[model samples]
Target chain A: MKKYFLPSLKLTLVTIILCSICYPLLIALIAKLAPGRGDGEKVMVNGKVVGYANVGQRFSDDKYFWGRPSAVDYNSAGSGGSNKGPSNADYLKTVADRIDSFLVHNPQVKKEEIPAELVTASGSGLDPHISPKSARVQIKRIAAIRKLNEDQLVTLVQQYTEKPLLGLLGPEKINVLKLNIALDNLK
Target chain B: MNTEMIGIIATFLITLILAFPLGKYIAKVFKGERTVTDFLLPFERLIYRFCGIDPNKEMNWKQHIIALLSINMIWFVYALFVLLFQGNLPLNPDGNPNMTPDLAFNTDISFLVNCNLQHYSGETGATYLSQMIVITFLQFVTAATGIAAVVVLFRAFAGKTTEKLGNFFVYFTQTLTRILIPLAIVIATLLAFNGTPNSFAGKDSLVTVQGDSVQVSRGPAAAMIAIKHLGTNGGGWYGANSCHPLENPNYFTNMLEMFAQVVLPIALVFAMGFFIQRRKLAYVIFGVMTLGMLTFMIPNIISETAGNPAIANMHIADAAAMEGKEVRLGVTASAYWQVVTTIISTGSINSMHDSAMPMSGAMMLLGMMTNCFYGGVGVGILNYFVFLIIAVFISGLMVGRTPEFMGRKIEAREMKIASLIALLHPFIILAGTALSSYILVHFPDAGWAVKPSAWLNNPGSHGFSEMLYEYTSSAANNGSGFEGLSDNNIFWNVSTGFVLILGRYLPIIGPVAIAGLQASKKYIPEAGGTLKTDTATFGIMTYAVIMIVAALAFFPALTLGPLAEFFNLK
Candidate 1:
């Protein structure tokens, strides 16, 4: 017992120092060279911080492309999903409300045509990108509200759509925050 | 082929290729043989010296278990203390408050058992000090503890009627310094380079285009995320887990995280073969596990990709179940992750599981309940052995001969212990779920401080699943939740804490005890009529036994939760 105790205590201290202290410090030093410097990548617009490129932000206006619905109201402090199982009454109600609101905003689009991504709250509650179809579905509403050429707006959404990484992982997505920023910048 | 299919195939190929050599190396490490890591022996010797441990000293299974349990108990207390007083501790840059006693208890046991179930959100619940000292520290040691326990069993198998199984402290420390640490360092470095945060700073405030300012929490997340996956300790530094962009920066990192979680568990299977020189038996077990995994995985992928039928009926055109899933992962990768995480008991998620399609939820539950399908760290093999014993017993009975395994007779005592351990998993999960359901059903408005209504985000069958998944995850020591259960309360914390203890220790005790007893028994040579456990027929029989046990025990609760949800969608 004594033999095991003394060794166990010593090893615990060594591991704490190695894993809990030195290891993190070393990783932090490496992270200093990464994109965000271990802070999140901040999106800037005319010298003002306008959210993070990686995180999803809520965009409710018709003139801008909408992102996925957020479960935590896009609170970066508390990122999570609504965690509502599909059959959950509250979850069904929330999705129904989102669909109704989306239909009212995009009057040109039929109920069936609205992409599921637009109504469903994202896993992180901060999905920065919407599916390309979700982006395309909102184009007519954005074009009418912003008074831009429909073709040009369609081209803009295309320009913002990111292809799957190495064409073998994830899916095609359009960054709603970036697309909307570009919309505000348009002449 | 589509990118999703290509990605899935590539993941499997790469994992198999890497795990092969890793298994051989792990076998060498535990066997105390000459290897590439021999240069690090001086350092290992120094660890032994510092602890006043004689590396040459061997312990019986009793001493090994005692060493493993006592050290773990000490850690449990240490973690409990750190969690309770995290606000007062240093390195708390965010000034996160101390945890309530119940929350602390759950967190401690969760991590201690390698469950990593987070009742509280990471950023708010724990300080940086607690994350590093308690959570990350346990991630390393608990994983090492599991490997050590299995190494003892390996000794029992390899050596003929040996009284001593190896030195527990030696195996534990060496596993940390050699295998887990090296792998974690490389992965952590890659994660940091790929933009996971490794900072000491607090939340960064940012103004959105909508002109609303939001504060985003940042910390030394990369280091924690690395070990969390590598050790199969799945608690996330942030609440969102791998879905967080920083935790999983891009596609490459996603692949890396998935690989890390399964590599050790898979490699350990091969390690078993290499150590015992029974490569054929290992292959049979591996085949059974892979077949079981694919059977669950393929259906889940197809169901998720086919999109939700209910949503389809509503005339939604883009029907893939995108809710609670990252576009970066999509349906295929998310579904794949769901199976992999649950299968290995590495409960980290790349997406929200609660929002997954009903069938996917059922597959996840099945993975946890059966658990032996390439389980977590060393424990995976440990749980599988329980099934192996039952399979051997049944096969013996079928052939009208007494069963013997690895030269040891399989008798009443071994079978009783195996049966008890096997049955214990479903018993705890079902009983806990039933109790929680009764409380919710009978006392909707009863003042237990937290109302039953407050317990579930969804009502009815889906709600029942949320409760069931919680206890299942806890009892499996898997730690991934349905995420809809508001479980940071006294009832959940206390109940799951006990379940975690029972689930973790009993399985360990049962398996190790059986192996110990088997090792001590008289050796019997192979005869003409001796059943070849390495044969394909034995493998199929083992698979059948696992399925039968799981179906008989869990089918009813599963029917209520995910199955009902599945049919309802139709």
Candidate 2:
């Protein structure tokens, strides 16, 4: 024990310092080398800026698409989740309310067809993307309101689908605002 | 009762078999007793040649200390830079931008002190290029350091007036080369096999069930997931924790992760005992620790399986309220993981603990409070040894005999130091909880101003239980959270961060100093009546000491939280 005192203390202290300092610096350098846009480009139609596809916006109309549940009132400056767990009575009540609200707006839609994301908020309230299936499920109502054929809208949805990067990155998804703008331009 | 528990129990049994062989191999290598690990002899010679490190040359204690300190300081500075600039980093598929000044500072201290408390989510706020590099590197180094520390301490326990404290560089390299890296690869491979996502792309597109095109957020999730569990560092790549499905897809992966997180720390105890030639004592410590963890977990799992009666009363019968949990994980896995993670000081979670049944939540909190008993990696074993010494002494005094642990006389100073180390977290937790609650209720514009008496979400005895759980989590260096509390806010972020650092370091420094102090003293041979620590009698005393100390310190706060919540629920 007498022989090991200095070395153990010295070794333990040194190890903590190495971890706390050297590692983070190396990661920072690697991150600087990684590529991507700092912020996404704004979506616009007819010279009027609509919204950024990187952040979610409210879709109150019955004929439009829906996104995940949010804690923030769709305020990007204050994006958040309710942080409510599945067992919270409030969480259950809120989801039930959303079910009722969705039923009122899209009476043609069946109860089971309402996607889970529509009733539950994403971890981050700022999610700007929805499932392609979520969009397709609302296709009939959206196409009817915009006076567009179901097949044309399906084509439009395909146009909005962003595939996995290089064909093998992540699950494919569609940008919500872009799809909404395309709906506005439907003949 | 859940299949997930069955799967986890199986994984532990399998990993235990694997760990013994591996631990034996490691023990042999470190003991300087010749073994197959020396097969990497040529690589060692090559590394020594490449790095200009000479193994044949014996260095004094000071020289070894300098080398260790220099490498650590480098990591510290690296972590600081990353914390200051996490934005503009690559592979941030969600394009999370940057942490605020307060949050960045808080996170910096949190990791630097080894607190493992995460106040900010990685998915939303941008973590800069520098921050990612610094943070992950810090994680890798800290883990290596922990294993390295254990290696050095093991040599200390075995040495008889020997000047050698073991090779720092060799220990560090071996920790990374042999332990962490290989474990990570195997676990990562297993996770990938189980369908956990592993990718570098920023985004992907998927067709929804409803037929709309949607963009999915993507990044290097698999890499982070492996380390987060392996290191017992619970910081998540996605904010939803293991619930992100991609990070913890199914029960098989969840089981593997639980094993990966827990097995190392437990194995290290055996490794410690083996190195010191006190394998019997190690088994006793392991037995006591396992009993403590299981006591909390079995009941918590059963309560959760019972489902929420209130929901049943409403005729909702929501099927076990596996809301914050993965459907594949179900109640059993979530309950077991919650307990395992808390026991091991790994904060990673597959379910939102804040949403668990009150009794289950209380169990999770209790696990953290006992974290000082057997924490992460080296720290846990070190903590247990401290209590071992104290318990030996106390029982020795009761029997009117000398306390000798592993043939060394336990003296007054050693016992004092050990007691101080073991008691540090309990003090910090109780005080921190009271202080925070006071500030929340009394401070101007404090978040708790509108404290809803009845609608307080967690209600009755549980309200204070949430507070107690948070305090326990932070103070014990177990970062799993009670979801009912608003912890992401500034008050908690700041206060919890403060408590977390003290909670982690005080206990660490206390035991470390004791070990160092013990090392400098001459060993006294055991007499005929030495109070043996390996006996079952000693094991019960050690368990009682740990549990009683924790209960006494936390009883009032527990009353406020779980106790109150329980009464109200009734």
Candidate 3:
């Protein structure tokens, strides 16, 4: 066994080390070069940063759009799906409850306008955006609360909406925080 | 009747048929007889010179196993340190204060063992940079170790007694260098190009939605996605798994990722056939594996197309509306990816099995339960070899003649070794599952027991499925979960980790040793009485023995889980 070629062993090991080092360095370089945009300087209200509008948070009010169910009491570290099945009675019940609660809050809104993602939590609870359709459905309630026209609210949702990547990666979505912050800024 | 089921069967059959000719081509390409390795020989030599390692010193099977084991052990220790000291590391997004000792220990073992039962979302929670280091790099090595083992087994099939078994370190290095690294680089680039986030600079900008602000979390996603598929390692960077927009990004990337997951394992059967000089054998094995995948997947897609009665009752558009899945992949593509990844031993999931129809979920569980017949990187080929050996043995018995496999006489010693090799994995998986179930039953309030009774949740059949799924995931080393089970704590982590290691190595060591023993023995010539292993009759027998053994070993547990859940539904 020891009589085999020494050069082969040396070459194999060196190539491996080089390859191993290459991946991390390349990733770092790409990350540095791309430097994907941040949620942008945090928004502040009354001197304290309220929150970035890029992640999901609970909006318990009857008139607000309800996001999906959370697994971790809204604990960011606990972001996860309920891991419940479609046939799960508990899961079904929660969906019904969310829909019912939404209806109660905005009695005039039709069911079809509600986006499934709005009522169903994205697999990760930290889904910062809701489908544009979901945002559109809740426009009337938000407009009623803030004394803005529903059309004006729909226009705002359209402005904040993001298209899927290269026009096909995901559904069009509107960030909840940005929309809510804009609502607050409305005279 | 529905497109989802039609899509699944079509995909499974296509992948199955494709695997064969592909396996044959690969077999020819890698057959040591081919010029690829020879052409790459200079590169291998160049690498050796740079590392200052002697290529002349060839290790036997035992020596190779030792080197592989040593690498694994060292990584385990290294991983432990990373987990222990994670709080001091950087890149912790949620500023997760720190992992508690018990949690850290559980996670440490989980990642190192390659069970990687990730129930926590890393960005939102506190995992030290060190923990991430442990989870990612060690995981790469752990996966590579299995691939290395398969490479060794491939050598055994292709070798004569006089030929070297190949160097463990060399195989290990080549696999990481030639295969994993390049693959990761390309896939990551492609994924990033498709808009899967690959930055650690943080949030990609808060956007407004429906009069509210939301924070869209961002990170170095492309790097992780690359390894996730390459390693058959499936811990999602975030808790949403591949379903997350950032992780999977788009359908084109989604298609690429699914292909990335299966290409290695499919290529490996050809690797085996090429090395063994019997390209036909690889085809047969590939055929059987494809058939097994189709059997489970076709039925699943069909049943799922009928839609859940409960969902249908609720007037939800039950006709293939994959509610829990990303609309980009849809039900068809998601189901296809799910079955392909699970059946091929890649655990990256695009669909939620728990939310998939019960029968679909059962198929996923069964896919894992079969130990990824296309198994792990190297383990899959080794497993097929084991099946091949058994095929020869049983046929030899039927013919009242001694068994001969790949030119080696299979006598009592070889058979005993084969039996031990064959039985150890199932023993660990089924035994551990049984004990866990018993403990759950006896102490219904145990911390691990998420739902003790079978009445609620998915109840009865589905509830049992949750248990079965957990065991299947852990024991098979297929990391996708039943998800519904509350296996988040120490007991499961430690216990499942034990099974994971045993499930991976015992079968590995057993098969390799048998190969070594067989290599040393003399080959018996074929006689009129010689049992023919290549026939379809023997193939059916081989399949029966394997399935029977698996069924008999876990029937009781199956009864308790899926069957029990089935009855409870009634």
Candidate 4:
């Protein structure tokens, strides 16, 4: 026991330095070459930093494109989901309420056109992307509020839409932060 | 197939293809044959010299157990103290407070056992220094520990009757240098470029385009996230784990993380085949495991993609299962990850398990309950080997002949150890759940940090499932939780802490002991009377043994929790 314990402790001590210290240090050094300088990539508008390119934002205004309902309200520092079970009565009522409110805000948009992603809270509560269908469904409301052409808004959503890997894998998603930023800039 | 389905299928196929070569490479490394990774010998020698370890010194199974347990003991003690006082430690820019003794006990044991069942949120509960030194450090060594433990079994099988299994330190260090470190660097590099933060920066405050103020947490996440998957240790940098955009970033990264966790477990199976000079045996084992995985995976995918029935009642358009899921990966990809993570025991979730459909929950439970369908790291194959022993023994009983495996007869002692290990899993899981349930019903106001009444996040049957899931995760060492369960209290922490130790060590000890005993037995060459353990019939028998054991032990408990919820889903 003594023979094994001594060596085991020594080896673990050395291993800690190698793994916990040197490994992450090496990775951090190489990460200097990555975007955002490894401090998280920032989304800048002109000369001012608005937010992170990957982190979602709260967009409750009727004039802008909104992402999915975030359980954490897009507080990136404390990210999490609703964690409400599928069979929970209160959770189902919350989903129903989200649907009704969407119809109230966008009376022109029929209930059948509302994508589920828009009504439901994302797992991370910081989902930057929305389904392309989610983006398309909100075009009319955004056009009416911003006084922009509906076809122009649809084209913007199309242009901002990100395709699946090799166009044959994953779902087609549009980055809502990028889309809404473009909306504010569009004539 | 739909694009999401294509995503799921392609991920699985690509992993299997890559695992073949990786398996052969791993076997070569363990056998001390020359390979591309030989360049790492100098570094390995340095680690050996510094630790005063003679890599050539071999040990019997007993010494190997002593060495493994002692090292884990050192880790648990050191990690517990550090976690208990992490607030006072340096690099805590986020100012997360120190953990109570109970939560620290649970957290330390969880990561030490390679479970990574985080009772506390990673972003809020842990500091940067603790994350690097304790959590990420445990991820590396614990995974290497598993690889080393399995290699002892490999060396046992490679030789005739003998006691010289292998040097534990040699296998441990070489695995770290030759396999885990190189693979981790590649995965970490890919993640760093793909938007996962890879620096020492603290949380940053920013205003959105919509003029909303938000504080975004940033850290040395890319490095930790890489090994978190590479080692099949699924504790995430953030509370949401891989679901967070910065942690997983995108679909390609999702596929990469999924592939990273699975490839090693599959490769280890092939490695066992190569080490034993029986590739066909490996194929049979692989076939059985893949089939077992698909049985759970298919139901999970169908249920998750079908959308939740409760939301379907809302008469809303687009009734896809989007709650607690991301749009980028969609439900199909999320469901695929759910099965892969649980079945493999990686437990890094991209979708919230608490909100998944009832059928999906049942499949996840079965995945953990079986716990051997392409399991965690090297331990996965070890668990399957136990099941194979039971199958061999049962079949021998059926035919009135002695059961033989690899060249040795399956005697009573080996059978006893295997049976105990198998029973231990269900016993710990069910007993822990039962205790929690009893507390909730009888002593809801019992004075703990968090009362029993506040333990559940969802009510009725789903809530019962949460208690069941917590224990199952701990006992299986799978680590992914229902998330909604408010389990950061003394009762949960203490109860699951003991469960984590027994779940991890006993099964490991049982397998190692059996392998050692088998190795020391007189080797008998193949004969006509011996039941051919490598045939397709044996695979079916082994699969039957696994399903029967899991179903028999867990079906009633599962019926009460997930099945009840499913039938009552509006």
Give the best candidate by DockQ. 4
The candidate scoring highest on TM-score is 4
By summed lDDT, the worst window of 10 consecutive residues in model 2 chain B runs over B447-456
Candidate 1, A43-98: lDDT as tens digits:
89999888877878878767778888887888788889888777666666677787
| Sequence-dependent TM-score of model 1 | 0.98
DockQ, in order, for the candidates?
0.70, 0.07, 0.19, 0.87
Best-to-worst ranking by DockQ: 4, 1, 3, 2
Comparison by TM-score, 3 against 4, better one: 4
TM-score of 4: 0.99
B1-570 in candidate 1: lDDT tens per residue? 678777777887799899989999999988888998889999888878887889899898889888887788778878999999999989887778999999999999999999989999987888999999999999999999999988888888887787888889889988888899889989998888776778898888777788777888789999999999988889998899998766786677888999999999999999999999999999999999999899799998988898777666667666678888887667788889999999999999998999888999999999999998989999999999999999999999999988989888999999999999999999999999999999888888777668877999877788889999999999999999999899998899999999999999999989999999999888888898888899889999999999999999999999998999889875
lDDT of 2 by residue, B1-570 (tens): 323445556766876776666666667766667775566778656655555555665433444445555555555555556665556555455556567666776676666554456666654654434334555445565666667666666765675644567676777666765666556656655555554444444544433323334454444445556667777776666565675545665456766787778777877877777788878877888789887887888888787777655444333213354445443455666787888888778887777776677778777877888774457877777677677677887898899987766555668887877878777778878887777666645663534423323223454455556667777877766677765575655566677777876776556555655555555457766666767677888899998887887788777777776655545442
Candidate 1 ranges with C-alpha deviation above 4 Å: A1-3
What Cα-based lDDT does every candidate model obtain? 0.88, 0.62, 0.62, 0.91
Give me the overall lDDT of model 4.
Answer: 0.91
Q: lDDT tens digits, residues B1-570, model 4?
A: 789888989999999999999999999999999999888889788888888899888899999999999899999999999999999999999899999898999999999999999989878999999999999999999999999999988888888999999899899888888899899999999999999998888899888888888899989998899999988889999999999999988999999999999999999999999988988999999999999999999999889988887777777776798889988878998999999999988899999999999999999999999999989998888899899999999999999988888899889999999999999999999999999999999999988778899988899999999999999998889999999999888888889999999989988888999999999999999888989888999999999999999999999999999999999987
Error of 4 at A143 (Å): 0.9
